[model samples]
Target: MTEFIPRPDQPASTSRMPSPLVTMIVAGAVLSLCMGLRQSLGLFLQPMRAELGVSASAFGFALALQNLTWGLAQPVIGMFGDRYGPRPVLVVCGFLYSAGLLLMALGGPTIGLNIGAGVLSGVGIAGCGFGLVLGAVSRSVPPEKRVQAVGAVSAVGSLATLVIAPVCQAIIENDGWQAAALSFAAVAATIGVIALFIGGKPAPAKDHSAVASNTRQAVGEAIRHPGFVAMTLAFFACGFQLQFITVHLPTYLGICGVSTEIGAIALGVIGIANAVGSYVTGRLGTRYRPKQLLALIYLLRTVAITAFVWFPVSAFSTLAFAAIMGLLWLGVVPLVSGTVARIFGLQHFNTLFGIVFLSHQIGGFAGAWLGGVSYDLTGSYMTAWVSMALVGLGAFVLQWSMDDRDRPAPGIKDSLLGTS
Candidate 1:
C-alpha cells in the first residue's frame, strides 16, 4: 500500500479523515453548550452579588479565578485530549462543570464559590472549550479550509449566545438564579453526546507508538518558538479585551441606567453579530495572513471601545456597541488556532493551542477582575476601559511582530499535513 504522506491526524485505521462538516457540527454543538453557558453567567453578576452580600471586587475575583484556573488547566487538558482524544476529556469535564454549577447553587460561603465557580468550572472550560474543539475541527478539514472550519465552529458559540442568553434571562426571571445555574449545568452535561460524534485523532509522529515523547517534544518546541511566543502575548490582549466586556457589560449598562432586559438584549445582539463576524473573519483568515488579520482586529477593537466609552451610554449605544464588539469577538480564536496548525502541523495541535490559550486566560483574569476592582474603588469603569484600549494597542504590535514563517526546531518539524 502506498503510504499516505499528507494526513492531518485522521483516525489510525483510515488514511483519509472523516467528514469536515460532521466534525465541525459536532465540535460546534459542544462549543454552543460550553460557550453559551458562560455567556449567560454575566446576567448572574448583580443578582448573585446582591444575594451573596459581596462587593463587586470580591465577586469579580472569584470569576477571575475561573479565568485563571481555566488557563492554568488548559495545557493539561489539551494533553489529555491529545493523548486519549477529546471524548473522554469532554465527558469528564462536562460532569465537573455540572457539579460546579450545582455547588454554586448550594450557596454556602465564598470558599464554595471559589471551589465551584472558580476552580471546577475553570477546569471544565479548559477541557470543553476552544482549544479542544478548534483542534478537532482543524484536524478534520483540508489545510486550505482550516480557518473557515474553525470559524464556523466558533460562530456556533455566538449563535448559542444569541439563543441561550434570552432563554437564560427568561429562566432566571421565572425560576431564580439557582435554577438558571442548574439549567445551564444540565446543558453542559449533555456535551458528552456531542463528543461521541466528533471526528479525528491526535497526529501520529514518525514513531506512532511514542505518543508521550511526541507530545513532550511538540510542547517543548512550541514554547520556545518566537512565533508561538509572540502569538501567545497577542492572545493575552484578546482575552483581556473580551472578558471585561463579556462579564461586566450587563452590569455596566445597568449602572448607566439601562434596564437589565435591555442589557441582555444587547448581549444577544453581540452574539448574533459575532456569528456573522466570526464567519467572515474566518473566510478572511484564509485570504489574508492570520497575524495581520489579528492585528487589524485588535485595531478595530480599540476603536470600538473608544467610541463606546466616548459616546453617551444609552439603549441604542449599548446595542450598537455590542453588535460591533460581537463581530470582533471570537474572530481571533479560529485564526489563532489556524495559524498554529499552519505553522506547526496537527501533531499535538490541541496541547500547543492550549498552551497559547493559557495566556489569553491570564488576560481574562486581569480584565474581568480588574474591571470590578476599578469600578468599586473609582466608582466608574473608566480606568479599566481606558486600560483595555491601551492593551489592545499593545496586542496589535505584538501580533505584528510575530514571524509566521516555519523554521525547524528540535521538536517542531515540517507538517505532515502540508497541502501538496
Candidate 2:
C-alpha cells in the first residue's frame, strides 16, 4: 500500500496563517469612513433644523430611525456578508449611504428629512458598520491576534471622528451645510469604490451532507449557549451609550451655552481620546478577561458622566468631559467582539455577532431618541445624564456575571457538562 501525505500549500489544509497587512489597512480605512460619516451627523443637526424648519423632536426622530434601522438591518447584512463576502455588501451599502446623504442635502420638510436621513442613511450604515467590516477582519487575521485586530479596526473608527468631525465642521462653516452634505456624500461614494480593493471571494456553499453534519450542528450549538446570551445583552449597553452620546453630544453642548466651534472641538477630542482608548484596550484584551475589562470600562463611563453633571460648564469642563468620555468611548467594541469569538468560534461569527449587535442598536435608538425627547420636554439634559449613569451601572453588573469558558461541542456529555 502507498502512504498518503498532505501537501503544505493545499488550500484545504487547516494550517493557520496571518492575513496580509494590506488587508488590515484596507479594513481600517473602510471602518474609518463609515464611523466618520456617522459621527459627523451631529454637526448637521442644528443647521439642518434651521434650514428645514424642523423641531428638535423631528430631528431626534430622524436620528432615532437611523439607529433603529441600522440595528434591525445589521444582522441580515452580517449574515449575507458571512455567506457572500464583505466586498459586495460594502459596495451596495456605500451607494445607499451616499444616496441618503444626497437626499438630506436637498433639504426637506419632516417626512423627507426623516425618510432620507433616518431610513435611507440608516440602511446604509447597517450594511457598512462594524459588524460587516470586523467580520471580514476576524476571518483574515490569525486566531491568536483576533482581539488585537479588532482593536486596530475600531481605532480607525475613532480616528475618523478625530479627522472627519473637524473637517465637516469647517465645511459647514465655510461652504454652508448644504455644501457640506454634498461633500460628505461625495466622500461616501468614494468609499464604495475603495471597497472593491478588498480581496477573498466568498466561501463556496456547503453541500447538503456537510451542512447537516457540521454547519447545522455548529449553529445549533452556539444558539443554545448561555454565554452567548450574556455577551449579547452586554453589547446592548455598549450601543446605547455610544449612540446616545455621539448623536446628541454636540447638541447637548449647545444647550449648555457652548459655541459651535467648541462643540466640534469636543467631538474631535472624544475621537482622539477614543483612538488611545482602543489601542490600550486592544493590547489589554490579550492579557485580561474581556468580561472584566468590560465591567471596568462601564464603571469608568459612569464616573465620567457623573463628573460632567457635577462640574460647572466652561471651555475647560467641556474639553475635560470630551477627553474623559472619549477614552471610555468605543473601547468596548474590541472586547465585546473578541469575547464572542472566543466563546463561540469564528465559523459563524458574523451572523452570531450581528444578532448580538442588533440588541446594541436597539439601545442606541432609545438613547438617541430619548435624549432629544427629554430635552424637548424639559429643556434640560439633566434627566438624560442621570439615566445614562444608571444604565452604566446596570451594564457593569451584567458584564461582571458573565462566565468566560469555551463552549462545549455538540452531543458530547462530558463537554456539555464542562461548558455548564
* lDDT top scorer: 1
As a whole number from 0 to 100, the lDDT of residue 236 in candidate 1 is 92
The alpha-carbon lDDT assigned to residue 290 of candidate 2 equals: 82
Q: lDDT by residue for model 2 over 218-258, one digit each (tens)?
A: 55766677766776777777777777788788888887888
Q: For candidate 1, give the lDDT of residue 293.
A: 86
Candidate 2 has an lDDT of 0.76
Error (Å) of candidate 1 at residue 297 is: 0.5
> Which window of 10 residues has the lowest lDDT sum in candidate 1?
1-10
Q: Return the number of clashes found in candidate 2.
A: 0
Per-model TM values vs. the true structure:
0.91, 0.89
Candidate 1, residues 1-420, lDDT tens digits: the string is 111122233322213335767778888888888887777778888877777776777767878899999999998998887777777788788888878877777755476578888898899888889988887777666677888888888988778888788888888889888888888778878886667777545445322223324677777777777999999998998889888887888889988999999878987898889889999988888777788888989999999999999989999988889889999998999889887876667667778888898999999999989999998999999999999999999999999878876655632233333322
Q: Give all candidates' CA lDDT scores.
A: 0.80, 0.76
